[model samples]
Target: MEGNNDTVVTEFILLGLSHHPRAQAMLFGVFLVVYLVTLLGNGLMVVLIFVSPLLHNPMYFFLSNLSFLDIFYTTSSVPQMLVNCFSHQPTISFEGCIAQMYVGLFLGIAECFLLAVMAYDRLAAVCSPLHYTLIMSKRLCIQLATISWAAALLLTLIAVVLQPTRFCGHNVINHFSCELQAFLKIACSDTSLNDLLIMTNSIFVLIIPFCFILVTYGRISLAVMRIQSAKGRSKAFSTCGSHIVVVTVFYGSAMSMYLHPQGKISSDRGKMISLFYGAVTPMLNPLIYSLRNKDVKGAFWRLLGKKVSE
Candidate 1:
């Protein structure tokens, strides 16, 4: 089904999670529950940050943005996955695919940058506590969040717009969602530039922020060690524990997904990893933050009390 240079692909089929009814049915239920919880968890984070004055600082500001991005990141894929599970034909139009790719890429990259910003915030809080307020000012936090969203969107937009996706003979995408790599696999045309761009962007997202996080955390760790009081050192480390846990979960999957050489990882592994970051991790983020950080727990209780009183 290879088309000539003049070939135009109007639609593409997605060979979703499984073909077996029982598998699909079971997956459908699981995905639906995860998607709902993702929305609820992230949505609640966003709302609580906005309404709770106690949580309106830079750390929570970046966190709310993360929650916001996670909401859309999961939304960009999981709904389609859920639909495809029940659908006789998991088909997406060319336009729909492009939209999905752009949204997913934007959010994915933004989250990377946002996490780096969070790392810097932690460094400031731990390594330079006296000036933490000035370092992660509300103004700076907003600027970082804005840059994360805008930079990711604009850069990805340039790539998607510059490279015209031409599907010659191949139109079957063997994934639940219109992932950029999966879409590229199905494009039956010259994709050298697109592949190069994906590689470059992926590398940038994977390397720069990750290096920064590691370095900042290293510095923070050193600073914590310098604290003479056991209680002081323990508190400082506690502040970072939740974020470190999150960073580990996120970067582990992201690195495996993006940094590996092309075609080395199986598509099945890719899908599972994608599900890990896209769906599962968002649900885990709030729980990690809440369970580990007493500030979050106290804030949650306070918010709940107000609601109960009302």
Candidate 2:
């Protein structure tokens, strides 16, 4: 009994979004299209940001990185999920599951902090126009982006290391991807400690940054109000609106999924919410920014026109 085989589960079976045979067949096509769109949308956004000199600014710098994060964040699970759609028993290796969970969680947390950074960038641009350049230097922007990514890794790594040690029985994950909550449901040990660690860290990655963003926007609102020109006020809101829309979509579904009050958001609920937050939002981000932000639209047309000439 030195190493009991029963004490360890090598893999987990994920029950994807639907259980119906007919639905499963249909869902494969649906998710395939979604996955492709997520790639194309986020991918093109990243490429456009890099190539367009007009877009080479601190704000677009963060947006480009955000698009990159959305690309990888969606990629971390969607491909495997698409494959699972056709499988009889959608299974993932223990290590594969751990890696997937960490990647998704890391990108998600990074986005939270990055969005907050962008919020501050907007605040300085609107509230402190004279010092905007000094406040958001290239070096400072790079450092902020670097810190967001590094902090996410550090925070998610804590859960990644702690969660796997708790896995003992019931390896059936009730979701398409190897999500932390899905793992928690099947973990044989008492998951109160793991959940506590998760909630505690969620404060950093989810709640605190969101609060900071709200506060920044409050000051931004006041600053915009004091501007004499209607056009100037309109322009300020137009610029910040895109970010606000994206933040709403991303955090709305994420908070619904993770920060529920009942403490028992069913796995059935989990699958639907994950499909939205994980797959749908990434596809929407580029469209939101491109359609609303005048600069991105201008850059996109310039880039497209250049490409056509070639």
Candidate 3:
């Protein structure tokens, strides 16, 4: 049965953060600096993790992969957005839009799961120190990372494949990039199934991981409290603090953008929030994790010393 179709959208115009001429230069400079920092920060982490034998543990191994994902995750959308900040017409082809959406969703979801897995790794290391190595072995770390990537890819594939069936009402996308929610709003087809699928996916990919992180942190807190020495408790809390902060920002902003009702909020306002999670969060993660970490700082100094000696 063929449904009534009025029009087909071949491309989408991305109404990025602002259209002001003066704001363009400022936004470009800001994002350019951010992009450079994001690249350098994440790239350095990956290199350090690979080169430094001290960082060969499962935690750093996962962190290396997380850094790599963050790099690509930001690259997938931010560059284009930056380009659009200067371009007269910021349009993405229909196919390009779909691709961007796919990559963004895949990496975003993967990061969520990866963070939870990292939390679990930390929990095992802190709460069960004796069995830490046994539980988070290299093989198990590889398996967990593989599962995170595979699950994200599978979900993204499903969402993209289902998208073609939906009718495109308009070619304009209000956000800076092609997002699932923004695209769904313009879909003329009955989107009940799509909405249901998105909700289910959110529960699995977002909510489940959030629950795991929360539970793990709860256990970690209990374990920290049990420590007799103040120094031990403080050390434990400090080690987990960075991860907790990263998780909070990433998940908090994402949930606010996706799960919250868009009722009275303007589309432009929503776009700014989306930009924070989708672009800004990825850029900030590596900096937050590495800059605040003693291990990472020590690794950086050693790497720099080696460079200086050469």
RMSD of each: 2.0, 2.0, 2.1
Across 1-310, the per-residue lDDT of candidate 1 in tens digits comes to: 2345545677878887657778899999999999888888888888888888888788898899889888888989888888889787789887898888788888888888989999999888887888989888878888888888888888888786755445665778878888777777766567777767777887778788888999999999999999999999888888788888888888889888877655667888887788877788887877777667777777778889998999
Candidate 3: minimum summed lDDT over ten consecutive residues — where? 257-266
Q: Which parts of model 3 have CA positions greater than 4 angstroms off?
A: 1-5, 164-169, 261-265
- Tell me model 1's lDDT, rounded to 2 decimals: 0.82
Model 1 misplacement above 4 A: 1-7
lDDT of each: 0.82, 0.83, 0.84
Q: Write the per-residue lDDT of candidate 2 for residues 218-246, one digit (tens) a residue.
A: 89999999999999999999898888888
* Superior by lDDT: candidate 1 or candidate 2: 2
What are the per-residue Cα lDDT tens digits for candidate 3 across 200-286?
887898788999999999999999999999988887887899899889888887877667533335677777787777778777878
TM-score of 3: 0.94
> With candidate 2 superimposed using the best TM-score fit, by how many Å does residue 228's alpha carbon deviate from the native?
1.7
Residue clash pairs of candidate 3: none
Worst 10 residues of 1 by lDDT: 1-10
State every prediction's TM-score relative to the real structure.
Answer: 0.94, 0.93, 0.94
